[model samples]
Target chain A: EDKVVQSPLSLVVHEGDTVTLNCSYEVTNFRSLLWYKQEKKAPTFLFMLTSSGIEKKSGRLSSILDKKELSSILNITATQTGDSAIYLCAVEVLFGFGNEKLTFGTGTRLTIIP
Target chain B: EPEVTQTPSHQVTQMGQEVILRCVPISNHLYFYWYRQILGQKVEFLVSFYNNEISEKSEIFDDQFSVERPDGSNFTLKIRSTKLEDSAMYFCASSEAGGLAGMETQYFGPGTRLLVL
Candidate 1:
């Protein structure tokens, strides 16, 4: 079975602190890794990492994938209360004949204190 | 920015009852999907549809579950008999391109919370 594991299931930090969320996966025919932020309802797309070493960044948020280690890390710098949410990491894998599915991690719950 | 939309944000049904969950994927998207998330659990893929046919489905998408693109726009999932284990938030998503070469970002709906008693 394909599995994606996330570390530090829950975290609480004061504003302006930096935090790193980790995700590791074990799967076959890897296609890509995606990150999402879930606030109250649906999850919003954050980043997609397909290659190893190269980091994808958006403003204060950045992510890097390490294929050699079978893991990825999402880093948030100078976090604010608005950054509080569940961060989800999903690994996309090809099953057969062009079919693909995303296996997701349990997600890391981040709470930013003011 | 266009977004996927789903109806009946919440539904409560008794065991053995049939229910249909509706979704309207982004108009320009070609690939559609259905996923579910149990409370405090990971989001799980149920099925993926393309060209008006089922391209792929997961083990969790059993015989009781069916998907249809009734019209040119509306996509629906029908559960023949609801079970307590079926209680979860059903999310609808769509992507602009096929999954062959990656670069497809799935935009998800807010999701419908289903409770089977």
Candidate 2:
């Protein structure tokens, strides 16, 4: 079955610390990988990576896809209390005719204490 | 910036009762999708709609599930008969062009939490 797995299921770190979350997937027709942050409700988009070795960054959050290893990583630097949330990784697979679906990991619960 | 929107932040219904979840995607997006997260479980894809027809669906999207774009501005997911297992946070998403060639990203809604008892 197509699947996504995230490591370090949960983490706790002091504010200003840097953290890294991991995600790996085994699937067919992989098109891209995306990261999202979920606080109280739905997830907010973070980064979407398609090319290996190329990193996508926004503010303190950055992500990279290693297609050769079928894995990706998300890095949050200078974390703040507001950064505490469940970070999700999802793999987008294509089904022709511009159709697609996202297979998501259980997500890494990040707790940033101030 | 335009974002997807869903109605009824919360809903509680008896088992076997039908429920409809509503969404309004970005005006320019052409592809719409439905996803759900069961409490601590990962977010799961339920179905994807385009041109008013289902383009793809997961195994979990069974006979009890249906989708429609009732009007030009709204997309809906209907569960014919709710089961206890159906209680979950259902999220609505839309994308400009399914992001081929890394062109666009799927925009997610705030989600509607459904409870069936």
Every candidate's DockQ is 0.73, 0.75
Can you write out model 1's per-residue Cα lDDT over A1-114, one digit (the tens) per residue? 899999999999999999999999999999899999999888899999999999999999999999999999999999999999999999988766656778889999999999
lDDT agreement with native, every candidate: 0.94, 0.93
Could you tell me which 10 consecutive residues in candidate 2 chain A have the lowest summed lDDT? Answer: A93-102
The parts of candidate 1 lying over 4 Å away from their true place are none
Identify the runs in model 2 with alpha carbons over 4 angstroms from their true place.
Answer: B99-102
lDDT of 2 by residue, A1-114 (tens): 899999889999999999999999999999999999999998899998989999999999899999999999999999999999999999998888677888999999999999
Sort candidate 2 into its docking category: medium
